[model samples]
Target chain A: QQPVQSPQAVILREGEDAVINCSSSKALYSVHWYRQKHGEAPVFLMILLKGGEQKGHDKISASFNEKKQQSSLYLTASQLSYSGTYFCPRRRNLEGSTLGRLYFGRGTQLTVWP
Target chain B: EPEVTQTPSHQVTQMGQEVILRCVPISNHLYFYWYRQILGQKVEFLVSFYNNEISEKSEIFDDQFSVERPDGSNFTLKIRSTKLEDSAMYFCASSRQGYTEAFFGQGTRLTVV
Candidate 1:
């Protein structure tokens, strides 16, 4: 099943901070994050494994909680270029499925102003 | 950096016509996938390919949809008798391994009338 993302949309100003959360009903092995601008392809951000490791780049960071089957993306000091929709594709345990199949969440739309 | 490349960028077709979207995944990658997103909706998985065969597919990938890796470098998704609902942005992605980061292509905007 597809994961669920919270705060369908968010608005932020330059230098502000925000958190986007994703939760899945099924147990997840890993979570992949991506950001998509208007009319563009989804850009890879980071991946969080089930070990509870936190991954980040620049001002964006993400953490995964295996027990809760949830992951969260933190955008620090947001910039105008950060304006986009964030998606979390949760990878479930591949007991009876393909390894590369990722179920994407509905996405969290973030709009950052100058 | 090596990235996935897609052709045409945009395509317009009539209902019941066949449409084929093409992609060139990064060299050395072992996994290829197809996804689509309708305007203002979430991205949906269509299928996954590996080792020149389909590894998994979603329900959205019905009988009307088929995928092929005609050559070592090219992968294609063919839709037979497309319907208006088939209009969406199709994205191709590839990854070095089954459980690694996958890079997405620019995507092909398909419009069916």
Candidate 2:
């Protein structure tokens, strides 16, 4: 199932902060965050694993709550380059070999103006 | 930096025709996947492939759709018969492992008329 993202859109000025949240109805083993500009493929941002393992961009931060099946991305002191849509793709904690696919949320559109 | 590359950045095909989108994932990656997004919609998974075989697929990957890793470096998604609804941006992604973050290609914008 697709995850749910809150605050469908957000507009912020440079140096401002913004928080994007994602929640899944089913058990998730990991949640991946990505950023996509207009007419572009999604770019990998970060990945939050179930047991606290994290990887990806050094500047961006995110947290995953296993018990709640939720994740949130934090963008502090945002820049004009941060203007894009954020998507959270999740992997289910299923015991099958076909666990290669990821289900992405609707995405949160963020616009940062200087 | 290693990155996935997709061909023909954009493709326009007629309804009921065949369309093939090609991708070359990062070297040494073991998992490959195909996803699509209609204009103004969420990205949807179509299929996943590993070890030269399909590992998982979504309902959207119907009989009209097929995937192939024809050579050592190329992966392809073929739509046997395209419909108007098949028009969308098709993205190819790959990961070092199934549990890792996948890198997406630039994507091929498929337009069916």
Per residue, candidate 1 scores C-alpha lDDT tens digits across A1-114 of 878998999999899999999988987888889999999999999987665889888999999998998989999999999999998886653533447877777689999988
Estimated TM-score for each candidate: 0.94, 0.93
Candidate 2 — number of clashing residue pairs?
0
lDDT of 2 by residue, A4-110 (tens): 99889999999998999998898778888999999999999988877455443545688888788888888888989999999997775344344678888779999
The window of 10 residues in a row where model 1 chain B has the poorest summed lDDT is B94-103
lDDT of model 2, residue A75: 88
Winner by lDDT: 1
Instruction: Write down the worst ten-residue block by lDDT for model 2 chain A.
Output: A51-60
lDDT, model 1: 0.90
